[model samples]
Structure formats: structure tokens, C-alpha cells
Target chain A: MTGTASRPTLEAVAARAGVSRATASRVVNGGDGVREPLVERVRRAVEELGYVPNQAARSLVTRRHDAVAVVIAEPETRVFADPFFALQLRGISKELTAHDSQLVLLLTEGRDDHVRVGRYLAGGHVDGALVFSLHLDDPLPGLIHGAGVPTVFGGRPGWGDGPRDAVPTVYVDCDNRGGARDAVRHLVGLGRTRIAHITGPLDQTSAADRLDGFRDVMVDVDPALIAEGDFTPAGGERAMRELLERRPDVDAVFAANDLSAAGALRVLRERGRRVPDDVAVIGFDDMLPVAEQTDPPLTTVRQDIEEIGRLMARLLLRRLDRAADEGPVGAPSSVVLPTTLVRRASA
Target chain B: MTGTASRPTLEAVAARAGVSRATASRVVNGGDGVREPLVERVRRAVEELGYVPNQAARSLVTRRHDAVAVVIAEPETRVFADPFFALQLRGISKELTAHDSQLVLLLTEGRDDHVRVGRYLAGGHVDGALVFSLHLDDPLPGLIHGAGVPTVFGGRPGWGDGPRDAVPTVYVDCDNRGGARDAVRHLVGLGRTRIAHITGPLDQTSAADRLDGFRDVMVDVDPALIAEGDFTPAGGERAMRELLERRPDVDAVFAANDLSAAGALRVLRERGRRVPDDVAVIGFDDMLPVAEQTDPPLTTVRQDIEEIGRLMARLLLRRLDRAADEGPVGAPSSVVLPTTLVRRASA
Candidate 1:
């Protein structure tokens, strides 16, 4: 009470309310069994003194920071390149808000950030983590596992044959392979034979899964029909150009995502190929606005991105609760939500 | 040491290292002024026991959370619509990470979140807050200000005739009015007399400022020459259509931002109008990929959005340091960074 003249301490509030420090503490921390009159007096005293409870101190006894960290391994530009992460973040935020937990967002751009993130998680600053480890060779999954924090991954991580692989990971991901299969089948239903594919960066599991789906359908297709893209409009444009040059007779194209699809559409327009008439096109991840705003719109695979985010948070929160209620029980199983093909003007 | 059987306490580490609890505490909490051999022994013991420091306990004595909350007033979708906020976040992350501060991101989508954010900020969970109160009528500014936590804003808030206006708010904003002026003046230099302006939602200060900038150059033009937008591509398309119907002779358009500009371009293209010959277009906030991806590319007013974020962090950290050294000095003044015109094929 006497430490900082301008700031009121718990002692001051207790003295003003004519109660013991213990009674004041109970009253301030929710007043479970405190008498109503005493609680009211303490509340009034707190209001008059403008007392703010120190969260860190309360968290020490409760062993709950009430905060969850969402670790995005990509740089900010990549995170914002499309609306995928944004929608996911919103879903995660909504759920965390419902649970009365704060979201500690960690965006790791490079190797240095990896060390920082690993250290932060191991330091026990947050209760649990929702990590987006998109890349197959990403070191984050291994580092995070080593940190020994309860975590739920955003996408299905590529678990290599290491000691880390033995640790079961709870993750929330869309059915990328199935979605790609649905897209390719739709193009096949359109009576298009010479179909080409533009894939997102192979390092990412989503892109790799999509590629596998494409191959599952086009088992004997020419290898020249495939082009590598980085899930950006620029990459889409380059890939589209290469595909057109390699097989000018190609009647349809399947792009990994909407941004690249938009770029491919632009190339088709430049080359005077009518959409769905001369060259039908389909894309994955209907990252709206881009999917909707592209000239003639886009026919693509749609994943409930927000739901994935929410599920990730729910899984992590459940794990945290399980850990708290009965030490650590068996980990929750991972989730794989379905994806549906959205028909539009393009395909 | 004996509270939780599985979790190792600081006492366990001290006992394992054969040192006094005080000596072990000194070593574990940085090893300042501790003997090198003793520090090594304590570190080895900590590693062997997997002892993680109790952050809450340490924070109670140090009075530092080593964390900052980034309060984004917008919902996740809008934040992700363009890369504007993403770049700003990256800039902030870069600076905060450099200073060893964790980022606690709080995304407020509705009214309930306002209360949650206010409570979290006032609870002394984090050292400070960087808030983005984009809308003029937003209640967030008032609630956050009432919390009495140190805060810095992302844009100029619409502070009406309230007692809140008396409190000087520190913020970081690009020169919206000035950037708009440059955009319109660029059109004027191109000899376009029938130039129309697409205003962003007037509820936002950035949009309002840009409209003022248009008026600053256009002077007394037809009121029909201006169209309202919500900074989305759909909004832009709607506004562009409205403008084309209102003034068919319009030869140029200056959209408040790039998404809107892209929409306007789409509309113009659909109407079979040749760009730059029949109509030229310009946009603000060259939000990278969008500005670059637009057909004919876009001439734009470029503001260092990332730098704005970095500068905001720098200002808040400076204030925090000043407050720590002496009681609060004069508040740091708000900053308005200059914007420059970027010429592309569109204009």
C-alpha cells in the first residue's frame, strides 16, 4: 500500500473495506464464498481506488495464463499473400474469445525466428500453441516438438522418419487430395483430354497432396503437362506460359490455388483462348474476392478455412484441459475436414 | 520442490547443483555476477531436470511482462483482404522481436470483444498495446483509453467532441490527404478533366482524408463525380459502376486504395473501354501483389506501410522507456509519414 503513492495496492483496498487481506483477495478473485455484503464493500473500495489485479501474480497460483500462441512459420508477406491465413486466424480468434483466452500470434520469418519461437514456447509463456507448419522440410515441427509444449498444427505436417515422428501430432487440415481429385474429375467430365496442372511449391504438403491427387487421376498423362508454381499470381502466370508453350493443344488447366488461377486466366485471355470454351480452368483454395473477382469468376475447390482454424483452437484447448484435469492423457486425434468443388463460369 | 511430482521446481535445481537457492536463482535468471563454474553447474542441473522458469513468478518481481498486445479493431477477413495490415504487422513484429517482446494479437470482431480487450489491457497482462481503431465511430478507442494502459494507434481515429479528445493520442499514419493530392494531381498532369474519385468508407479517417485531398485538387466539380466505396473489390466495382453511369465522360479515376482500383479496372474492361485512352486509373496504398497483378499494372501512391508499423513500435517503446526512467514525460507526438507517387501503365 505504501510502495507507489499514486497506485493503490491490495492492502489499501482491504484496509478501506474493513476486511483482512485474505478476504479482499478472495473478493477480488471472483468471491466464490465471500459474503455478499463484504464482496460489495470490497468492490466499492476497489472502484474508488481504481485497483487493477496483477495478472502475472494471479496466473502463478492458477497455473493458467489464459493465452494461446498461434505460430505462423511463414513470413508476413506469404501469410498475407492470400486470405487463407487471415480467415484461419479469424476462426481461431473467435473460438479463443469464446473460451476467454488471448491469442499470442508468433510470425517466424527465418532461422533466427525459429530459435526465438522455440525458446519462447519452452519458457512456458503460453499454455499451448497452434502452429502452421506448411513446409515438408520446415524445422518448426521438430523444434516445437523438442520444446515439449502441447500443440495443434494448422495443416498436416510432413513427419519424416525421426524420433520426432514417434510423437503423435494433433492437426486440423482440409482434404486437399480429395478436393484435387474432385476438380480433375470435373475437368474430365467436361470432355477435356489434354489437361495440364500448375502446382503450388512442392515443399508445402498441401501442394504435394494436390499433386498426388492429380497424378492419381492422370496416371499416364505426359510429364510435360505439369509446371511448378509458388501459389502466387506471378508464379501462376509463369507456369501458365510454360504450359501453353509446351502443349498449345492443352484444353484445360488445374491450378493449385485461386491466385495462380487468376494469373492463368489472364494468360489465357492474352492468348485469345475463351474460358470453358477453348480452355477450361479450375483452382484449389477459393480464397474469395480473388476467386470471385477474376474476370468470368473462377470454378475451384472450397475448403472451410475458418473452420480449420476453429478446430485447431478447439483441439489445443481440449488438450490443455485434459493436461490440467488428469495430467496428460492420450493426445487427441487429428482432424481432416472435407472440401467441395464450387462451380462457377470458368469450368 | 515437492508440490508437483512430475514438474521440477527451482529448489530441485538448486539441490541438484549443490548450491543455495539464492545462488541458483541468480544463475538461472541470467547468471549475472555469479561465478562461471557455479553458473555452469546450475545450467547443467537445469538441463538435466528440464527446469522451466516460472514466467509469472519472475514477472511479479520484475514488473515486466516482456510482451505487447496488438489490438486489431477490424475483423480477420477485412484485415486479410489486402496486404496493408499484414505488412504493418511484419514491420511491428520485426521491431518487437528485436527488442525481445512477444506479440499478443487480439482481434476484435464484435462488441463483446471490446470489453474483453479492455479488460485484458487493464489487467496488466502485457506491458503495452498497439491498437488499430480504424473506424471513426468505433467505441474501442474510448474503452482502451479508459483502461489507462499505454497505447499507440495505427490510424487517426474520429474523436468527436468528447472528454477523450482532451487526451493526446499517439498514432502512426501515412499522409493520406497528401497521398491523395499526389494521386489526383498526377491525373491532372495527364490532362484528364473528367477525373472521378472513389472514396473509401467515409467512417474511416484515411478514406475521409483522401476524399478531402481529391477536393483539394478538384475544387468545385460535379458532386456526381465522386463515388463511395468500402475499400473492398466489390465496393470498388459498385462505386465504379455508379460513377460510370453518373458521368459517362469520366476520363480518369483515383481509387482510395488498390483493391478498389482493381475493381474499377475490371468494370472498365467489362464495358469494353480501353485503359489510359478512354480512362486512366490510379490507386493509393500500392498493396504490392494487387497493384502489380492488375491488368495494365497500376500507377499508385506508395506509402511505406511497413515503416509505419516499425515507427509505431519505436515510438511506443521510447515512451515505455521514458515512463520507466521518470514518470510520464510529455507524450510522444503522433507521426504522419510522407507518401510518393509510383508510375505504372494504368495512369
Candidate 2:
């Protein structure tokens, strides 16, 4: 390594390597699509010259910072403790660490923070972003799209049918519809007719897809059997109480997530309704801590959240790696991981 | 305003503003000291020229990245879901957003990851760092110090008396000792003489200080009354079980954190020990979900974790802002926030 005062420049390295500046820049960025011999020559030249690419200067040339911004845009503080993001973050961290990339975590406060996020992305602060935009009217999608940074969303984004809709983006998500279908199918198999559903915030695609899945299975079902929850224990409790008030004979319940199911379970216990006896209950997102620790233990749909995080990172990295080559990189398609039924004491 | 292709350079802006390039740079990089009129002129020239100082190029001159690396070196996944880091991150995010800076999060896995972290920092990717070095044997402090990046630690780092021990670094910590004292005092006020303690992992300073605080209150205490936990629910369960087996007549318990207290409460309930009636319980960190949702609400020591995060960001930002002027930003002093006792039903 050369001393900072006399650090070698990319031009000098390129000259020494007997290569064009463009080729050297490509090699430094990632060496994708470059011939192995030329890549090695450039690499040796860089080492020999002791050239350290200044992050800012490097960005100016290659437009790559080797950093991905993880934008967690949740308005509700209760969800912060839900362990979903934690598992996903761990997965993302491991994958990014392996790639020698940095994670710039941006926890947005509200609508105002969305503007800040958009500006930061547009300003080229990071190479790509992994965003968790859970709401339909979030406005972040359009903003992020306008910024033109390659992004892989954590969950499927909700887009309106308006003319000014956001461009389709790549995302990694669990099969929420299929997961809900399995949960409801399990309840149906238990010979429960008056099945009630507790949905997470419908503004999110996951909740909306789950609701759709429920509707698909229970065609001609009574609307009163559904109650909205914000995916928190307290919300689940409120929704369960509302459902109980509306349908006294409800024999099965499918809460969107384990946290909501935990809340619903507490309510059922308080009302003296025996789980799986009076009403078989199933929850989605078999979050281990909540699913395992609930009083009777919850029978739920389990999604590999950490795997989703890893896949998101992998997709973004691949896209970024391809961008270094002298060709148009095709837009990446979304990835949807399968969910499994986790049977426990609740059902 | 200038467009991206023809974005103005700092030198051009300096000429337009009739100031030296250094003065123009100072203005661009958070203009800390230069007179008001010159600052205004430089800013106007920047606006007129549509100047966006290349982040890496700016760093080359100012030696400031306008970014801070937040190093969280916890190997456990449970702590990630504890909402402690979430609250602290929110605080740090708000402060950094206000200052127009970026937060590059570094989550270390093990020894190999530590080497990667050291290399990245030494490579000068960020202006400074906010490290949470929980373990006593963490080799990060020495490696980070060697990297020459100005660092402000989140918790007091534990160091052994070796020849290469790191210099006393700036840190922000809650008064763990004082909080523990308050917890013990609350138990003592309830006339609990046969009080037992569940200590957090002793590798962390918070755990050690809290244990020290317990000793300060309970002189000549029975060694068998204390059991060690890793600040996890499972760890708490194991420790509580061990404590109960040792001191069958224990009338009170002080868990180092709310999660541990929740675990201890579970054990007490399973063992048919009525909380606050048979055995009063107190916990630290006052994490709302755990503290408030326990069978009986937990009495806890409340430290403002978010405030600690905000203060850490503010201190590091202040140091970076001062580093612009050619002067020794003398050693920064540490900050210790006070904790309060929240008396809930369990106590």
C-alpha cells in the first residue's frame, strides 16, 4: 500500500498496465465481462502502483459506491419489535458482508422522511437500495423510481392503478396468497364453516394478497367475518373482539401474522373460547418466538424471512455486477419464496 | 441550475464567488467557521453553478466523509429483536438526517468479520464511527484505533490490561450502576431481604456495572443468590432456574433487563410463585413491550436509549464539524444519561 500523500492515481495505474482508462475503471468496479488475463494485469498494476480509489472519485467514474441503502419505512413503532425485520436484516447482513458491500440503514419517520430518502438516493449516495415499502399509498415507490437507483424491495410493493403509477420493480416476497390459502385450507380440513379472518394493514400488498387468498377459498363468504388488524398484538386483540362481536358462531380464525394471532389468542382465552375446540385458529408468518411462545402455541404459515433477505441482496448484487459490463442489463424479475404450514397446539 | 452532464466544479465555484478554493470547500462541507458574507457568496455561487461536490473528492480535501459507520458487534440474534437497537437507530437516523450525513451500518459476524470491518474503516470509507463493542475480548477497538478513524463508542468498551490496550475513547452510556441501585432499592423498600439477582452477560460493561451496583447495595450478600444470564429470555430462564434451586426461599429478584425479567416471571408463574405477592420482581431497560406485557407489568429502571443514540451522533458530528478548522479537536468527554425507576404491578 502506498502512503496517502503520494497515493497512485487510476491514470497512472492504467498507463502502467498498458490498458485504457475505461477498462481499468471496469475492472476496479467489479471486473464483470472482462477477460481474465486483462483483469489480472489491471489488478497487478493497481497493487504495484498502490492505487487506492477515493470512494467519491471512484463514484464519479464508475458510479458505484459498493453500498446498499436498507430503507425501513414503517410508521408504527410496534412492528419494530416483531422480529420479522430482525431476521431479514441478519440474512441481509450476512450476504452483504460476504460481498464486501456496506449497509446504509435508513429508518424513515413518516411522509417527510420519504422526501429525504428520495433525495438521498437521487444524489447517488449508494449503489443500490433494499426497501421495505409496505403501504399502498406510500409515495416512496414513485420517488425511488424517479431517483433511478437499482433497487430490490423487501416485500411486494402496493401500486395503485392510476396513470402515474410507479414503474414495476424487483422484490423478494413470501407467497402470502399461497400461505394464507394453506392456513385457511387447514381450518377447512378441521370441519370449521364460519371461518373468520384477521388481516394485517390492507395498505400493504402482503395483507391484501392474504385477504385475496382468503376470498379465493371462501367464495360467497359473509363480509362480517373479516376484521382489520395493523399486525400488532393490540391490533389483533381489537380485531378478534370485533370479529367475535359480529359472528358469535365463528368456528375458525386466520390471523395474518403470529403477533396478531397472539393478540387474538389472548382475547379468545379472555372470552373462554377454547382454541382448536370452539374455534381452530391459524396464523401466517410463523415467527418462531411468537408462534412457539404463545399460550397454546400457534399453528401458522412459516416463511423463510432470512432467505428472502439473502435473495434480495443476491439479486441486487447480480444486477449491479452486470451494470459494470458494456451492455444493457435486463430488468430483474421478482422472487417469491414458498411458505410452509407449521402445525402446533393452537390448531 | 446546472445539469448533471455539466455540473460545475469547486474551482469554478470558488472563482465565481471570488474566494479561495479552500473557503469554497469549507462552505460546501457544512461551512462551520468562515464569516457570514463569504459563506453566503459561496453558497450563491454553488447554486448558480449547480455544483454537487463529489463525495469522494470532497473527502480528499476535508478528510470528512459526512458519513459515520455504526458498528454493532453482537453475535446473538435475540438482541436484534429486543427493540433496544431499533429505538437507538431511530434516534441516530433523525440526528444524522438533520445534519445531512449518512449512517453506514456494519454488523460484524465473528473474528473474520472483525478483520473486514478493520480494513474497511482503515480504507477511509467513513469520517468516524459509533461502535457498540459489548464483549470484553473484542479485538475491534485496537484494530479500529489503528485504522485512525475518530470513533465514539455506544457502550463503555471492556479492555484487558495489555501493553497494546486502546486509548480511553469517547463513549455514551446509560447509568447502569445507578439504575441497578434504584432497582435494588425498590426491592429493599418492599422489605425483601432474601433478594436474588439475575445478571446479564458479564462480558459487557453494562452487566458488570449493574452487578457491581447490586454488590454496592447488598453487602455480605450470599454468592449463591446471583446467577448469570446473557440478556436473553432463554438465558434468563436458565439463570432463574439456577437461582431458585440455590435459594428456595428467595423473596425478590432483580433482572438486568426486561426480557430477562419476562423470562424469570414465566418461571415464577410455572413454579406457582405469585408475582409481587410471593416474589416481587424488578428489571432494567424498561423496554415497553416486555415490561408492560408480562403477566403482571414489570417494575423497571428506565434509561433513554434513544437519547443515548442521539447524543452519540451529535458528539461525533460536532467533532467532524470542528475538524474542518485547522486545530486539535481536543479529546471528547463521555456522557452518562440518568435512569428512572418505573414502579409497575410486579413490584
Candidate 3:
């Protein structure tokens, strides 16, 4: 049962208002140049008939959809298995709602979905896009660039070689490097010299930046102390086990995220090690439920993930608004919010 | 720079392919009635010029955008702050991706957002919608129904008083009643008659159905043993505290969800009650991360949340496909998936 078939049309509205078709059309399209009396009559008719102007028809004239597409390229289910992306989405949703814009979510699982996302963007549906391209080797950046849609990235996107390889684009990122450094620094301050690092998947820029931050603090630390994790609790358990086998004397660990840290803690407990006595622990991304609920509450670095999402939307919306006012909008500057270390019992 | 302004038009493609504009247009719009040689030439010319047929123009002819909107209306931060919604989304995303449909996310925080979402759905941007309205008093159902979009609800929707008040609709849900019965039966087998129940917000049909299931097992149970929880660990903690005060002899607790169970477990520990030895605990939803990570793992009822999401999309997609073929489609049937009892340390 399609109610749209019975929806009143422009002709019906004009008939009900006792106005010319041209007058009704003009009033419906923002009442520009139309007098108050005719506009009022048309508005009353629209209200009575409950005639919603089809956006498809409106976009044909204005060439704008008043909607933004949010493309999230998370191939691994690990990312969605946690609350990280959910919090970011909440923030983005709130900001978009405030701007009176709709959010069209385009989630890509892998390479095939990437092409689907690319085609959708190129289809000229939404006003702009907000993309989260975490992995270094991801082709999404190049595809979105080629689509030529105005887009703002969620994290600091990594391209060819170095950070400078990042194309000049508007993005919002937390101080991942700074946060990681603080976590390690706090561990070191607690007299933990044999500090081991469990990194997230290095393909992601956040994980890479976090590892870099760890290395910056532990400059002369043993290479055997470092191991890779895929930003999952299980991965953290495996990496932590490997680090313990390689360097049994390791007294402290800095995990890339709270989930990984929880895993590491579990491993340490099973091995009959006393937290803060035998081993000190620190984690990044002070995820509250995970951090506070741990056996021995975790001391970690805090990054306002929701804030990062809100800022990303704000940046993209500003660009869209500026573009609407005139041609040749300047490239908006990227933002990196500061991170602070949250002290707890573990470290 | 506007890529669309410089985008190659049908006239340019026709010129390059040595054909008329009408011929090029026909080829681009699925090449029906056009000869193979001309279609091939036009396609090559279009590819070489990187021409993307405007969807805004195309939708006018097809009257379909091939996009689906997913409206998640949860005002509280607790829902989005956990992995529950994330798993459902992953399931929804995978299903929608398989069908080659885009997901437009509409998250509403308050009453204002409900109106905004109502208007957006009425605007007819997407072909159909998958809505999650967890609360009974929520006006979203009425609004979405008024919008007249083909929709499939996430759970068994609760209208005013009777089940008959529910508008005839397609929906997907887990067997909450069966799952709860299994949980209570397990506790009864353990010889725990004074079992307390921590329920999720009763305004939701899932919570109400779960309570009904609990009553199904314990006919002579005390009414004071049941306490309302909002499906958060914090809510669980509060409910557990209230239950302990009312009936300190309570030998078992059945939390409506894992997060609430985790909270109840924490309260039990704080009150010096050893799990299983003093008070056994069982939770619903069996969320892996929370259940396994708890001090002693939680025995609970398992619902395939992702499958619920997948089925919801399948039901809506089938309706949309059928609607395209002809006359008034029949009332689509709702689905209720089976749940299993996942045994763990707590019970």
C-alpha cells in the first residue's frame, strides 16, 4: 500500500489555493518574489493537503540535496565489534541533526564495497561526504579524491610514505602520538624501565602513530619488547604472551587501546603476576566501561573520540556552507585535538 | 572546483562516438533497443571521458534511489556507548551491501529529532526504511507510519495497551519469551527458588516479553523480586542493590542483558556474595566481550542480533522488489528467530 500515489501534487495545491500554477510553484520554492497573501494561501493549502515537496524534484532545480554521505571503510569486523565507531557515529549524528542535514551512511567491508561507495559518490546524490579511511594502503582516499566530492576525513589519512604524503584535505584527528607518549611516560615515571608495547594493526594510521609515540619515549628499549596487535582483546592477549616469552623481565606494558589493555591484563593475571607490584599497565583511548571495569582499573590516555567526530562534521559543514555562498572556497585547515593522561590504579 | 560543471555530457559523448545525443542517452540508460556496435562505441567514449550519469536526473525516470534509510531512535547515550548497536549495524550493513543498496542513518536524540526524522522520511529520499523504536511511548512509530514508507521494524513493536494496537507491519525479533523461560528453568534446576529478576526498561516490548517468560516459570513468585533496569551496568547495579535490600535471601539473579548482569555481578561482589556459591547470576544477550571478561563468566540466553538485522533488511528488500512488480502487495509477515541458552560459570 503506497500512500505516495495519493499524495497531493502541485496542480492540486494550486487548485485548492485558487492560485495560478506558476504562483503556487514560486511560493513552494522558498516564496521568493511572491507576495505574502499568495504565499500564505499556498502554505495553508500545503498544510491542509500535507503535500511534502519531493526532494528529488527540488534537487533538479537547486542542485543540492541538503544531505551528506558518511563513508566508513572498516573491512575488519574487529572495528565494529567494539564501541569506538559507535561513539564517533553518535557525535556525528548529533552535529548533523543540528545542521538540519540528513546522514547517508555508506559502509564498505572491503575492495568490492569500495567500488560501490565510489559509484554512489560519483552518482551526485549528496552535497558532500565525511570519510573515515584508517588504513594506510586503503584506496578510498584516491577514489574519493577522483570523485571530486568535497570530503572531510575522520582520522589523519596516511598515503604513500610519510605523514607529508597525506593530501591537503580537511580532517579531524586526536593527538594519537601525544596520547601514546603520555601513556608510556606515565609508566616510565612509575619506574617501569622494561616497558613493552602492544600495537594495533600498523596499517591503520592511529595504530602507527601510537607505535611511533611509544618508540619516542622508549628510545633505547629492547626490540624484543615490542609486539603487534590487531586492536582486539584476543590480539592483545597473543601479543602480550609473545612479549612475555621474549622478555620475561618486562615489568610494564602500554597497549594501543583499552580493549587490548584488558587482554594484556588477563594474560598477566593468568601468569600469576600482581598488577602494580609485578607489572604496571597503561592503555590508550580511556574507554570508560573497559577502563573502569577492569580487574584493577586501568590508567590510560584520554582522547575525546566523540569530539573528534563532532569536529569532523563541523569542518565539513562549514566547507559546504562556504561553497554554497560563492565559488572557490579555500581549503579548510585540519584539526588535531589535544589528549590528556587519565590516571588510575593500574599504572 | 566543481567536477560536475566540467563533467562530460551526453552531447559530448555522442560527438566522440559519432552518434546522436538520443542514441548516447539510450545507451547510457541500459542500452535497451540500441544495437550492440553503437552501444559498445558509446560505452567506450563514456568511459574515456569518465562520464557519470547523474542519479538526480535518472531517479526522475525510475522513481527509485535504490537507497534504504536506517533510523535508530535512542535518546540515551548508554545504547550507543556499547557494542550492542554496533553488532546490529554490522549485520544490517552486510545485508544491505549484498543487495547493492545504500544505508542512510537517521539517529534521533529527542522529540525535535523525531519531527526532523519524520519529515526526512516523508521527503522520499530513500526507497524504504528499517526502523528501531525500542520504547513504547516513542512517537516514532506513529510518525514513520504516517510517512507511509515501506518499513520493517527491528523488534516486536509495542503500541498503547493491547498487541492489536500495533499497526500491521513487517518486523524481526528474537524469541525473548522463550529465552527467558530457558534462563528461569535453568535457575530452578539449580534449586534456586528465590530468584530475582533485573529487567530492561519495561516500556520496550522485549523487556515486557522477558518478564512474562519469567512469570511463566515461577507461578508463585513474589512481585517484589522484580526490579526495572535500563539495560546499562549502572542500572543493573542499582536494581541489584534494591533487590538485595528487599530480599537478602535471593539466591539467584537473572539480568535482562549482559551489561546489566555485569553491573549486578559487581554489586554482588561488593556485597561479599560469591558468584554461584552465594548467588548465581544469569544474563540475556550473552554479549561475548562482557560475559567472558567478567570475574566469573555469565550464563545467559543468546540471540543472534546480527541475524535479526540481516532478516529485517531481507524482509524490507523483498517488499520493495515485489512493490516494483505491480499492485497492492500483501501484508508482509514478521519473523521471530530462535534463541539458545549459553552456559557459563555464573549459573
Q: Which 10 successive residues of model 3 chain B have the least lDDT summed?
A: B159-168
- How much DockQ does model 2 earn? 0.12
Q: Local error of candidate 1 at A277, Å?
A: 8.3
Model 1 C-alpha lDDT per residue in residues B1-347, reported as the tens digit of each score = 01122446789989999999999999867758898999989977766565666665667686676777888877755666556778888889888888877766766556545655655666666678888746765556655654567778888767622234345678889899999999999999999999999989998888999999999999998999999998889999999999999999999999999989999999999999888889999999988888999998999999998998898888888877877778666668889999999999999
- State the DockQ of every prediction: 0.16, 0.12, 0.22
Tell me the tens digit of each residue's lDDT in model 2 across B158-239.
Answer: 7522222233467899999989998998899999999899999998999999999999999899999999998888888999
* lDDT of each residue in A1-347, candidate 1, tens digit only: 11122445789989999999999999877669899999999977866665656665667687777878888877755776657788898899889988978777766555445645655665556788898846775556545654567888887877732224345667889999999999999999999999999999999888999999999899999999999998889999999999999999999999999989999999999999999899999998888778999887999999988899999999989888888888867778888999999999999
lDDT (0 to 1) per candidate: 0.81, 0.79, 0.80
Q: 1 or 2, which is superior by TM-score?
A: 2
Which tens-of-lDDT digit does each residue in B167-208 have in candidate 3?
366788999999999999999999998999999999889999
Alpha-carbon error at A240 in model 2, in Å?
3.3
Could you tell me how far off, in angstroms, the CA of residue A167 lies in candidate 2 after the best superposition? 8.5
Query: lDDT for model 3, on a 0 to 1 scale?
Result: 0.80
TM-score ranking from best candidate downward: 3, 2, 1
TM-score of 1: 0.72
Index of the highest-lDDT prediction = 1
Judged by TM-score, which candidate is best? 3
Q: Judging by lDDT, tell me the better candidate of 1 and 3.
A: 1
The residue pairs that clash in candidate 1, if any, are none
Q: Against the true structure, whose DockQ is highest?
A: 3
